[model samples]
Target: MRYACRPVGLLSRSDPISRFDVADVQRFYPRGRPPQPATFDWSFTMNLLGVLPYWQLGPWELGPLTLHSFGLSVAIGVALALSILGSRGQKILGVSGDRMQNFGMWLLIFGWCFSHVFEVVAYQPHIILEDPLVLFKVWGSISSVGGLIGGVIAFLIWRVRNPYEDHIGWSNVAAFTLPIAFFFGRIGCALVHDHPGADATNFVVWEWIRSIFGDSLPEVWPLALQYPDGVPRHDLGFYEAIIFFFLTLFVLYKGRKPQRRGYYLWTLPLLYAPFRFLFDFLRVTPGEAGLHGDTRYLMLTPAQWVAIGMFILGLFLWSKLRNEPLETWKGLEKSTSDDEEPESSSE
Candidate 1:
């Protein structure tokens, strides 16, 4: 069976400048020099044996509100991540639920707001130049890398205000739980098929995947989507979801054992950045025929530059904290109390 789908609500064609169609520039390009439209097939055939299933889920209407799948997934991911963070903070670091909730709230607010800012400033500065008011439209667009930077800023601000808290331990907890949010967020991207890539019909990895799945491998791998021209192309979001699925499992398993205070915090970026940097190469470029790609700076996508920075940050963390002692729940609790003692005495 085959299904053809088109986005509605936030990602609908009604908004020529919607987040998913950043490459569609027919409306904004210079006169007489409009770029080729990057169109893709919204229809795909179901293959029981395919390794990945293709589907596009749009938004739903609830009275006056239109609920987007991507937004809902992000909300669920945030809720789940915060729940885990709160439970872990209380049990491991002797932190109160209220404190943890406050931290999470700030992190979410800053991270979400800046994601849109970065989307415009880094990925599409022209949007802001065209209309400065677009900067205030936090729901207009977002960049995952921007969210990470915003989270870091939130952490820094929180650390300054709560000097008595076990900030390092909290960082560890965040490193362990943040991937859960990332995995689900990427799933939302996959469902929307927003991050289209270049043609992948001849990608060699599929041969190995085919060998392993045997008859289970679909004629068209779910990782690839059929373009309007009938050629299969990689879907970057689908690939990222697959990567994060394994990453989440690995971190959760490792978190079971006591680790250094900055172990996962430093190491995850080291492990993930290279892959992200490489993946950006597979993305379709602006001038690519039949497909619109991401905006690039000096030939590198914004995410690619962010990946490089992440790698450098990871290396710096490793150099600074590699020698730190293993951290345990009891140890962290005691450390937190020790930190609080000075403030208590002064008060």
Candidate 2:
């Protein structure tokens, strides 16, 4: 959902952002003296305004296995996406459920592997230089944009292997379902407060909201998370979760009717890339020892670069597919039946 790497021996041993604890604030500073209070006291206005309390859900142990809430949420998201893909493939693309499931599994494997690789290679090249083996550790770190790139690669590979498949139709299916997965994946990020952003205390819109509450509003925005120094910063993950939730609804509504083959494949990227590029601006910059922030190059994060590419790709697809015919469920089913019918026996 966001870029994060566990502490290697060479890197800062401070806990991962997801694992940040209020107690750790004291230790984060010199001589056990935090610059400000490590906790906040919410007022009635904050509660009424739906400001979330600072909370962290740690991993749970089951026998020898550890279950993290983020991982569990991702698992659920993937499962839901696969289910939708399987069902929709048959009805909308004339692709079988089994085939869709196989495709989804491949996408999942490749998406996960690439997510780790992108994180290690693009965001933290230093990690790879330190230990070459870190590249093989697929569970180490991940980027959401990396997963998207992986999904595209996986689609290309699948198309090559199954050349007769309806590539455009399948792409539409994937584009429609991906937001559902992302919605939950981002929720996991929000739960952990991993994607921290710049200070929102004086953000104009938040300031306006605060003004509405008069003196009853707390100094910190209800949606903001306090850093070790007690500065309230926007939680980018939380904001994204809310955005994706609405996006999922929008796409679902669109999917209810027949549309062009590449409608979603192009439109989704066009809609999402610009917002994502803007959101990264709010992401915290690299902090002490490169902890608690995203890596940037040329004044832009890796995801911003990827977003630019996505926008370009979306434009290309839109230009090419704009003239294509719309595809309906019944039409796809009839075409599939016609293709499956055996040729008449020769005399």
Query: TM-score for every candidate vs. truth?
Result: 0.75, 0.77
Model 1 CA lDDT for position 285? 85
Task: Give a tens-digit lDDT track for model 1, residues 1-347.
Answer: 11111332112233344443443343445555544433442223235334344567878999999998988887888888888888777767777766776778788899889999998898778777789999899978888999999999989998998898778888787777788989999989987877888877666677677767564445555567775556688889888988888889988888777888889889899988998998999899876865657888899999999999999999999999999998778746677899999999999
**Candidate 2 stretches greater than 4 Å from native:** 1-47, 204-222, 227-229, 288-291, 330-347
Give, for candidate 2, the lowest lDDT window spanning 10 residues.
Answer: 1-10
Give one digit per residue, the lDDT tens place, for model 2 in 1-55. 2222322122233344454543444345555443442233346435576334566
Candidate achieving the largest lDDT: 2
Spell out the clash pairs found in candidate 1.
41-228, 49-216, 49-218, 50-218
Clashes per model (N, Cα, C within 3 A): 4, 0
Give stretches of model 1 more than 4 Å off: 1-53, 204-222, 287-292, 331-347
lDDT of each: 0.78, 0.80
